[model samples]
Target: MPDLAARLRIEFHWRGGPDVVFADITEWWRDPVVLRDLPPALTALVPGPVPTVVLGPASRGTLLGALIAAHLGVGLVEVRKNDRMALHSPFHIARDLPAGYHEGGARLSFRRALVRPDDRVLCVDDWVESGGQALAIQDMVAEIGAAWLGLACVVDDLGDRAEVRARLGVRALLTAEALQAD
Candidate 1:
């Protein structure tokens, strides 16, 4: 496969305090070939097939998680950010999320049906930063008596790599350094 990282464009986004550089893969993903190849490229990152389910939060994470789960031939479970679905015995975590998330705070929920005591899950997302949500997910997984195989992301913008790894093993396709503008 081609060097996908090098093909991405970078855009500067202002998030109140400072300008944040974002790796814009949306355009590159528009290409049918590239979109088709995403699953294979991401599958290469996983160590092995240890997870019975792939868990992703709403929005971007949910989209990518579905792809990864399909590639791995596992069940895809969504952690909802809203009460859109009628939940049955859901596990919830309310906390101060990062800037891009809900302003004051966000409530994250995982349905009891998707998460089981014996499940071995893989967490997938578009990006991971601050790791607040991921940590909360980890806590919920533990409470459910489930195992976390690892976390995979399209990008790693968060600087504290060690801290994130300490909490949950992570594999990122691209780092913020690689996404910086020329």
Candidate 2:
């Protein structure tokens, strides 16, 4: 996994959408080398007291969380994003998240039964930019009386928002600038 960061940069690309430049990690997912190296790499980002259970925020996080959870020999909790299907399904939603796709309406939910008061949680995502999701997840973890260890992602794009990462205990295998390398 020594060359993982380098390989990640090489496989990473930027996709131009109608209004934005989104990162395309499809190539990373396709590379067996990356798949084999990623989980351990992300797990290493967290200092210690490895999580007993991991949390992924729907979509990408769900996939990444499963991999990393397996690496740590732990379990995963899938966090749903504003999905009506979660209503009354033992899922608790995090409130008052920062503006995003749904603005202030952004919400994150998770199954309360899956999380316990003494469990340590490490949230996994492909990328972390605004950190609103991590904060929201923290709220839900706190509500369940679980310990929120922090966030672990493939990429960290906090820019000048260093304080946010500090506040949320964010860590990543690559920085946004690392993927921009030539």
Candidate 3:
């Protein structure tokens, strides 16, 4: 586990509140110390050579994913929470994210001609608490027949990386832990 992952896990598990952990984790990325520490931490967690696509909720996870993509020299993909008219022909797939509402009705859309068939996608997010949203992005990648590289987050409170990997069929990378020891 990378040091950032440990820190994120601690932060999400300890300092974050029920309604606020998602925002808290996202906000942490804005801090210079945390931002500086993220890329290396993410690089340490990924297990293989698949490229990345970031799954963000409009304003939430976009910057983090974009930064990581820039650092790794890869592309970024957005998973929108609401539908947009411009994405008329986007490839649609349903996902159930951790903190998002609904069991499985959440949908993800990309610009129609954005991704190629041969693209291998690593899904990035700001946090992975329930794995639902990540799973949804994974489903979208599968629908496009793109190789599902892996899932990376700025925080992971679930603790069990194995289960997350098993469910999403990709290793989960977290940058920090919200929990702290006294």
Candidate 4:
């Protein structure tokens, strides 16, 4: 399944261009193993009783979060892109662009009410390009007074795990190189 997904990914990159590479689960899920293996890898990154919060623009990360939550027998939360009418009292967080990437001053908002104050959260995304998005989610968790377990992604492209950890104050679980090597 991973192989098939990898093949699809390669094809996507080849035909769709580099920016269109949808390596994240929520974006391109050709198999179930991508979802299956995510939890354990995430667990290895953060040692705690943390429930996973799927960050949105809903992608493979959302599916991965649902699978992980089901596997762990925990609840799931979503960090949405737009403040819909359903999210009346939503919490907002500004995501800074990660180092080296263009398009600065981009910010994302999340609802704090979606999670409980006592909930320990592990932010899950399909991919980590800059680490800024992940860091923004972490900041939202912090603002809500919820303990953050860490950040987990199907693919981490930045390669600077230490910088992600230091800036986000949590460990990054996966890297693009690791996934490609697998």
Q: Which candidate order results from sorting by TM-score in descending order?
A: 2, 1, 3, 4
Q: Per-prediction TM-score, please? A: 0.79, 0.90, 0.70, 0.68
Clashes of 3: 22
Give candidate 2's TM-score. 0.90
lDDT of 4 by residue, 51-100 (tens): 64444334455676776677677777755544453334435444444444
lDDT of 4 at 35: 49
- Cα error, residue 128 of model 1, in Å, equals 1.1
Model 3 alpha-carbon miss at residue 56, Å: 3.9
lDDT of 2 by residue, 62-163 (tens): 988999999999999898887776666655555556665434556678767889999999999999988888888888888888888889998999888988
Residue-level lDDT of model 1, residues 1-182, one tens digit each, is 44565544332222333565334455644566545665667667778656899888887788888888898788998877745443343344333345565355566776766788889988888778667678777877887889888788877777766877667777887776666544
C-alpha lDDT (0 to 100) for residue 124 of candidate 4: 71
Estimate the Cα RMSD of every predicted model relative to the unseen true structure: 3.7, 2.3, 4.6, 4.7
Residue 181 alpha-carbon offset, candidate 1, angstroms: 4.5
Which pairs of residues collide in model 2?
none
Measured by TM-score, the strongest candidate is 2
lDDT digits (tens) for residues 1-182 of candidate 3: 43655555444433457765323454465456667787666656777774745445445567777777788787776667656543454345444344335444555555534556688776766666666667766776777778876766655645566676576644445433434331
Q: Give the CA lDDT, 0 to 100, for residue 104 in model 4.
A: 40
Q: By summed lDDT, which 10 consecutive residues of candidate 1 come out lowest?
A: 8-17
